[model samples]
Target: MKPEVSIVIPSYKNSPLDLENLHKNIANLDYPQVKVKVVNIKVSEGKKRIGYAEAANKGILRNKSDLILLINADTKLDKDLLKILVGYTRKNPEVGIVGPKVYSMSDPLEVSPVDLPVLSFNKFFGKMKKVDPLWLENKRKPFSVAWISGSCMLFRRRVWKKLSGFEKNYFMYWEDADFCMRTRNLGYKVFLVPNAKIWHRSGASIGKDNPERIYYVKRNSLYFLEKYTLPPGVILNGIKTTFLIFVKTLRYFLGEKEVSKAYIRAVFDYLRRKKG
Candidate 1:
């Protein structure tokens, strides 16, 4: 028998029409024939809203499937996407986590397999390139990566039991990479299945380059770096990464004053958090 699959989508809504397109895509997935369960996780409590990490944690704890596919509401849920991902995981028990080669909806060729968040200028600022010409030959092969975007990821239920899901405190950024690192630490590899493609409306759920995104990303980058950097490397890593932080601030300051302010505040907040 095929392992049971459950899809958990964490959405923050302004109105019911918020997930209208995403719902339509799911409705188009031939639900009558497909056997997967879909759980729509609303990240709201009363009038206020919660973070993606908290919402996903709740969804995972509530579901009881053999496999879990967590995706954002802004992604195009292709007809064959779930089947392909499930088949790959069923075949490779060694893979604790798997994600697809997601392309930007604005441009299909541009794909990014998330890299490990190491303390380096290149690691944080470098952009992902388009798929290889060989990919055009339709050789949708699987490859290992340090991490992949949280936008669309698949993992076994057992992995969730072990890792306890995303760190709820992270709220949004860096938690995906943090989870991947912890998963690998348990002797399981994280693989990217390129053929299992989908389109993510990049920055649709949250505006691109907005203050919230900028602040969370910068704040969480520091948290992630501090967590991963060992004792002996802490001082050196802090000095080098601090320089990159100012460099990032300068780049944003040249473009938008508000964004620069958010960057500065992120550092201050993270520092204050450290002092506490």
Candidate 2:
């Protein structure tokens, strides 16, 4: 029997053409037991903009299915993608959340950094290595990961309720990592289903180099670090992370003064929230 799946897409100020493309792609999927819900957030006078987490929760509340898939408005799916994800979850009961291999729409083979490593302040402060192309091409089996991008993820409806959906305080970023960490604390595993793939127009909803994006990312990183780190490590990591942020601010200021200012403001805002 085919499992019922609800796809929740959170969209903000998307163009009519983009919505048509997204709907058309979903319509072509081979899966018969699927429902697509778009939680649209429009910006206008006397209306406040809703963030990704809240928008997603709104869509989730509208559907009652066995499995839920969270996807962004800027994504395009493959015909068998939903079938593959649902089939994997049905077989692996221990896996609570599954994310697909997302590729750049402009360059199909270039995978998005959705399959991220466990969060570590040391790594954040140190030099990072690029993901090897050989490993990406060779890894055909589903494997456990620290977390998967919320851009395109599948999980059981029961699990979503258990976690109480994405953390609303996150507003926009780091919510996926927060969700996965909480899911792991409950003894469930998060996996990357390499075979189920999709194409994403990276940062289409928000511009890639937008200062607002930079602010949210930096602020949210601090939030996650504080929430998860142990006491002594928290103090140590906090200092290290702050220093790293300062370094980044200096570097960004050289090229983009507005983005640098946003980064600095993010640190101050995060600190103020912690004290209050």
Candidate 3:
């Protein structure tokens, strides 16, 4: 039996090229009973009140299906991706959330450019890329991961209901990781289906180099680190990140043309905000 699938896509003021890429990707998808819900988010209007987490939550709330997919506006799903994920979730009762191996749209078989920052979480979870000649020859099975990128992920609706969905406290960064950890604490596994694939337009939701993006990444990450992990670790990492921000600010003050003063403001936001 084919399960119902709901795809929740969050879009900002995406470039024409990015939207075109996304539309092209979904144009030929083969899923039979699928519903797509799009939530358009503009940062200027969102204003820390509703960031990615809230936008994504809005999309999720608008959906009604047994399976939920959180997708970015810049992704294209493979024809069989939903079938594989939904099947896995059904066969593996212990699995709650499932994600595909996302590749770069520019380089379909390669990792996306934004894959770096979350490498720490991947390593911590023992999901280092599989590299073996024989293993490469065989079809891979769904395997557990610490967390999956929010760009393209699928979850059981029941699992999401049980976990109470993404934390509204988080504005942007690390919400996926925090949610994954919450799922884990509830004793459900997060799976990465290597065979199920999608092409991701890197950093389409957040302008990769935008000073505002830098700010939210810093501020929301601090919130994540403080909430579930040790404070000392949070403080230590915060100090290092804060120093980097100061150095960038100093460069801007010295009349560096490209380094933005907005970057410094982000650091202040990170340091001073009350916990949400």
Clashes of 1: 0
- lDDT (tens digit, per residue) of candidate 1 on 76-157: 8677777788888888899998987777777666653332112221233232233343352354668777777788899988
Q: Model 2, which residues run further than 4 Å from truth?
A: 33-46, 114-133, 245-255, 274-276
Whole-model lDDT per candidate:
0.73, 0.77, 0.69
Query: Model 2: number of clashes?
Result: 0
Candidate 2, 1-276: lDDT as tens digits = 687788887776567787789888988998885455455544221456667887777778988887888888788898889899989999999999998888878777877654343323233332223345457656788877776778889988888899898887878888888888788878999888889999888778778788888889888877887787666656776788689777877777578678788888888898889321
Estimate the overall C-alpha local distance difference test score of candidate 1: 0.73
Error of 3 at 15 (Å): 4.1
**Any residue pairs clashing in model 3, and if so which?**
none
TM-score of 1: 0.82
Lowest summed lDDT window (length 10), candidate 1: 113-122
Q: Alpha-carbon error at 189 in model 1, in Å?
A: 1.1
Q: How close is candidate 3 to the true structure, as a TM-score?
A: 0.81
Highest lDDT, which number?
A: 2
